[model samples]
Target chain A: MKYSWYRLDNSAIMYQMVLTPRAQSLFRMGVKLKSPVVPSALKCAVDKAFLRHPFFKSELKRGFFRPYLDENKLPFIIEEDDGVLLKLLDFSSNNRYLLRVSYFGNRFFIDYFHGLCDGTGALEFLKTVAFYYFDALGIPFPDKNILTLSSSPSEEETEDAFTKYYRKPELGKGINSMAGGQAFHVRGKNFSSTGYGLIQANVSTSALLDAAHRLNCSVTVFLTALILASVAEAHVKGVPKHNLTAFVPINLRKRFPSKTLGNFTVFAKIIIPKDCPLDFESLVPVVKKLLEEQLGEREVILKLGFTSLMSKMPLFKFMPLFIKGFISRIGRTLSTPKQTFILSNMGKIDIGENEVIDEFLFNLNCNKKTPDNVGVLSYGDKTLISFTRKIVSTEIERIFCKKLASLCGEVKVISNFREECNAL
Target chain B: MRCKNCNVEIACKSSVCPLCHKPLVSDGEVPFPTPATKKILMGKFSLAYLVIAVIANIVCITLNFVLTPKILWCVPVLVSFIYVYYFVSVTVLAKRGFHKRILGQALILTAIFAAIKLAIGGNHWIFISWLPAVYLVSDLLMLIFIFKKKNEASKYIATLLLLCIFGAIPCISAYVFDLSVKLPSIIATSVSAAIFIICLIVCRKTIIHELKKVFNL
Candidate 1:
């Protein structure tokens, strides 16, 4: 009769609050292996990986006060990939599991509901599954750093890092005081249907790194600046330019040491004023300065602490779950208009030194308000920048690839809209 | 392999660049296979049904206007058409759980029956027979499902609880509207109350655990 359940983390609360049929906060991480995926082997790999990371074998349950994760006893089945990017998961049809694993051709994909974990956590699970997949095939992996089936999961792995690292803020000093001004929203006609269109640009990692180094900024900053410049160029002529803000998610595990496999990330709102230079060269330093200021240890902690404090307030804590969910949806809707786009960089992903995987792919789902979102992931020599959009216009994507081609010399483009392109 | 207009290498085997739509200069291996075309099951059938329903309604409305405009005989036909469409889509064809389908059909039927009774200027059978009968049937069906899927009883408990809540409505309406025939409403409420009490007594631990999981702060 008793089942294990977990209280959602502070960051996860926001995700649960805004969860709707239209705005399902879902993201995907996948890898393209050298050989075609064997279904039986992949199934064995998933079963093996589930032992080490049993927290992912859970479902979202609506609690009286909030939503919690309940242990799901249903079999974790690996479905065939449907090719639609970031399709919404129907919990009832999916046996109430919050995550889905599917394979197509040589690629294996894991699409996770954002309430389950952040990108870093999902990447760990994906790597572990891949490691076991190769192991099931009787192939040896070169690197042993991956969490294997042999090791037991640690208690720290399931801890709510936001609560663990939350420090009481000094009186009246640590409250978030950022301006609530609205950012320039990307406007265009949406796709007639309800799925996302993916456009991935594969560039040489070394070339991108060198370009970023030349700009005296990290790859994330460099790419963020480039995207800002692209958005500026694609801005319709004769319209008043508003400030562009990029919602960049920063992984907290790097700053504060915790092995939380739940949601343990905060966002940095990097705003580029309209009057500021919109050129790529000029945007680099501006983005760098803004990122540095917002990404500081103190600032990040303060933001996390403020969120923790808000979630724990007696008023919100005791409120009924349905009312809380209603308020959360409203808050998300009101807050979305203040941002232009999202840029989530998962940084370098290293599963092992094996030659099995050809590349890694990461993608973020777009919402009605923010119809354009980008996900970046680097593996081996290839850095993939995936643009997931709900809109039909590819002007932003076109300008982005053109600029990257001019910078990196050659950018390989792959898309699901090839048929649409032929018609055009 | 290269697209001159976009100045980027074409990764897939498509003839034109996905971004700029310019023809590529060289052929290359496709990294991603073409996505399988999605099959829209029942799309054509649904469209045909909708077209037929629209035409039927239009003909009926025109006939009513010409033959007996003051009576408005087409209204019930329109309501029946709407009810049939909802019943087919949600209860019959929709990929929903059995519990949801049963509850949905029960609620919609009850509403339609009540509306018809009210339209005919009668309210006695609705309170004494129709409403209680619908609630009792829904509650029994939910209980059967819970028992059939005993191992996964937790999954169906919420629906059962919802049916019990609906069971109270007939009794409440009887009192609120001061209906003369109170026996059927009383019987429905008592049955629902007994079921609720029995569930608490028999599966006390499981019910408490479920409640805790649902209401945890």
Candidate 2:
């Protein structure tokens, strides 16, 4: 049967090509409510939200040239599975939803295939669902500031923003390129035997803000410096400290004026030299200075432009999916050791006038390469800093959280270690 | 109700907490409601497939009788139909499991090979030459489940051994049948054996662990 689909955009194509069984390109963005989530209410909320957002209603389909998102025919049911981190999306199954809604206790988590959308797109869908869910639960939500269900999906919402903003390739110029070098690799027993060791450390937003104020930097900058210091201290023998670079994703929406919900994000590397002292005071200034330099108009343009140029090239566009996938896999492996770890701070999301949402938590995927990742998000008074790792050693997470706890008094840490979800 | 262990509040009447699976006791209102059963479209697809297969088989049989009376071309058509039916019913229709699907594929391959041999009048060579090779490949796959630790090095060693066996069997059978494909078989066996020996030397520690697990020592 014929299905309506679109060519997988550049961001989406990379995810499809580089996915491995051991290292599925998957991440979880979650919401915790003040009260427990009602299953029927969540289903109702999902149904209403799905109608408003066209992206969530679609599934990935493998085409002759590349994979594309097709309209899903099966029921989009909310699952209650918590056995593994991000269960691979099986498109061949009767239900081919790219994103899965799973609930445990008061938490509702949405796991994405990375091909569907990025963190910003995911948060938009989650916010709408939370709005509808509270409304369905007899608790009315104010529509003034909340992202309520739209009557119709705007064409702009589903447009490929990369195509809209891509510029023609310049013949001769130095592209904004990150230096390739080995960084400190976190080594531990592979938790592939068990599942991913999930640890969420919740700190007071006010305390973090106060700490950031004292440091004269943003919360993300302060936290990134703290993480860098922790990793520097944990650095093993023989690894050069000069090569330590923390990979941070910079959302382009702040710079670019478009609401198109495909992947519109680029990465910046925070590099520190080996001779530099391993302390927060020493690293914070360097981080702030580098971030200022990296986020410059010229630098950001070149960084984003290079990716768009690659996708637009006829050579890459016409290459078979497997060949592209193979190249991407190799590229990821060679680049994986260049950075210490990936830290994504989705920033604050306002779940307006809804008393139900307690906080938002973000967690990155655990892969064979660069198995440990940190994700941060804040809502209301709580800022959840989550650590997702496939390694048995919690050294990095412990060091990072201990530093965070010192900065922000009384941090609450929770874990899913050795815990299994009860089957329904 | 709240889990004493995880400190997360539970909203179900079931004494066990859903998240950490710890026990809890307290009268708490059900959080939302149990989700309704999803309406899957598998039944509709199966019904349509069944209807198409039935009609096609009948039409093929009728065409065979009308087109050529002496040839009995319906035999091949019927064989293809059986293969499709077995694949759909065994693999697709049944509950999905990794081992179950592998077993189903093996059974289907065996049936297809047997049918082709019969259709070709006397190809005892298929059972002697190709079927064992296919079985050796499937057996390598089944070893994944049997060992439970799929990442172990010994499984790959067994896979390489089976690869060589796959090469050696065909060569031996070809010799018995006096066929002309001996040189290619020897090359396959030698290459597989060399790879296997290299892997054994490189991953000795991992292979030892795998062997211990297998022997239960």
Candidate 3:
């Protein structure tokens, strides 16, 4: 019998190459409902949602040249949430599914392996699952705009957007400017085990927007500037001064206009030199300007083209899988020191004015090199800015919260480290 | 609900601020549940096994030296200890696939037995009898696994193919070293080749598909 399979996307190849047992490229996006979750309803809803999205019913398989997604026929099992933020997804234990869906109390989370899909794609899946869940609960869903179980899977949803928009550049022409030398690395003792210390700061969406508007910048740029300044203030006194850079992932769908749910995002490296002003107000323009330079249409297209082109190079195409994986792992390690932290703003998730849902949560997994990362998602007046770190020190998060409180008036914080702190 | 030290609202119901670790003024609901503690005891248990194995090996060696310096009974004891530790840690306790653990155990045991034979300067029983028998058992186990989990044949076929390659190694080594007992090696190589041929004929499409997926050719 024939089976459905797909070539790993241009960006997913990198994720697969650098994937280790320790460094699981995982991230979570979840929703907290007003009432406790029903296990039977969630299981039924997940089954329906799994059938709806055929693209997500596959597993990553190692190929001779590169990894590919093979159709997985294993029964989809919805697990009870074990209270871990971004827990490792053991493929053998998870029946080879790259993504996991689990519920705890009123919240249900979908932790996705980056090789399967990026955050936007995973959000679409989450919304669909949540929509089916509410349906199973016999509750009315206010949002008809989101993808539901009734929607049919489309071929375009699985297309490689990076390859689709690849415009060959002129011969011998390359990017004029590149990200400069090594950014300052964050220092802290890692967690005792493989888990993240999560701190979610809930603030009003309008308040954050108002603060960003006052600085004449977007919310992402404003937050990036704040984080850079906070890192500088928190670590500069003790450590050697170095340039601070934040990697902000920009969704390519907005500019390229593709509905592909595959990995189709590029990052804009916003660097603040060691000598630059460390205050929030002065750093905004620098961030805004640098963001603009990297996010330009021509620059993004060039990057997309080059990335896709590199994957298609004869040397890369013919290299054996193990060799390619080794090379990519080395490449990732070498390039990791060039960035300080990752700041991913998932933008606003409009689930409509659904009375049953309380708020949305977005959490990112940090690696050993960059121990602290941020994930932001806004839903229904509440914008949750989450700090997921592998380290113990909260000095950077403390400074960031204090600065954010001064701007947003009030910031409500929640964390998974309450037990640890209480014991201490 | 608010933490004065951090100047932020304590959304969770913890007694102290998550950031500043200071007392909060009022109580609130915790948004996230406490994470389940990990199984760190398994790691400590493995370490304990290692310590015991080391002490046992040291005592056995010292006793062998004191009691019978002419004899080398401690060699087998050391090998047995090493195999026990490996079996407990990697085969029994490691978080890996069932097939991987079994295959790994088979390979390690074969190497250990071969090393013992060489260390003792024994006869060619290792190559003529022991090696062939181990290869046959491993090949049969892989075949059974493939047939039992036919739906997941793709996952097992690559390993089976690897076993076929390993099966040929003993035959080739026996010839290269010119061991007098060549009939067993010939019989083992023939059996392996015949099994491979049968697999190729019976599941030709699957074998080809698995190779294409594996090689991406």
Give each model a TM-score. 0.86, 0.68, 0.89
Higher-lDDT candidate of 1 and 2: 1
Instruction: Place model 2 in a CAPRI quality band.
Output: incorrect
Query: For model 2, how many clashes?
Result: 3
**Best-to-worst TM-score order:** 3, 1, 2
Candidate 3 residue lDDT tens string, A208-279 = 999999988999999999998888888877444667889899899999888887899988888786677788
TM-score of 2: 0.68
**Comparing 1 and 2 on DockQ, the stronger one:** 1
Report clash pairs, candidate 3: A64-B214, B1-B26
Each candidate's chain A: what TM-score? 0.94, 0.91, 0.94
Which candidate should be chosen as best, given TM-score against the real structure? 3
Candidate 2 chain A: worst-modelled 10 consecutive residues by lDDT: A415-424
Task: Give residue A318's lDDT in candidate 3 (0 to 100).
Answer: 83
Docking class of 3: medium
Model 2: how far residue A282 lies from native, Å? 0.8
For all candidates, state DockQ relative to the true structure. Answer: 0.43, 0.03, 0.51
Tens-digit lDDT track for model 1 on A1-424?
2237777888887788788766778999998999999999999998888888888888887787878888888788888876667778877678888888888888889999998999988998998998889889999875456787567788787878888888876546664334446778888777755457788999999999999998889999999999988888897354436678998998889998999889998888898876787889999999999999989877887778876775667898788878988887777666656678899999887655777889988999886678789999999889999999877778889999999989887898888773362222
**Who is ahead in lDDT, 2 or 3?**
3
- Tell me the TM-score that candidate 1 gets on chain A alone: 0.94
The numbered model that scores best in DockQ is 3
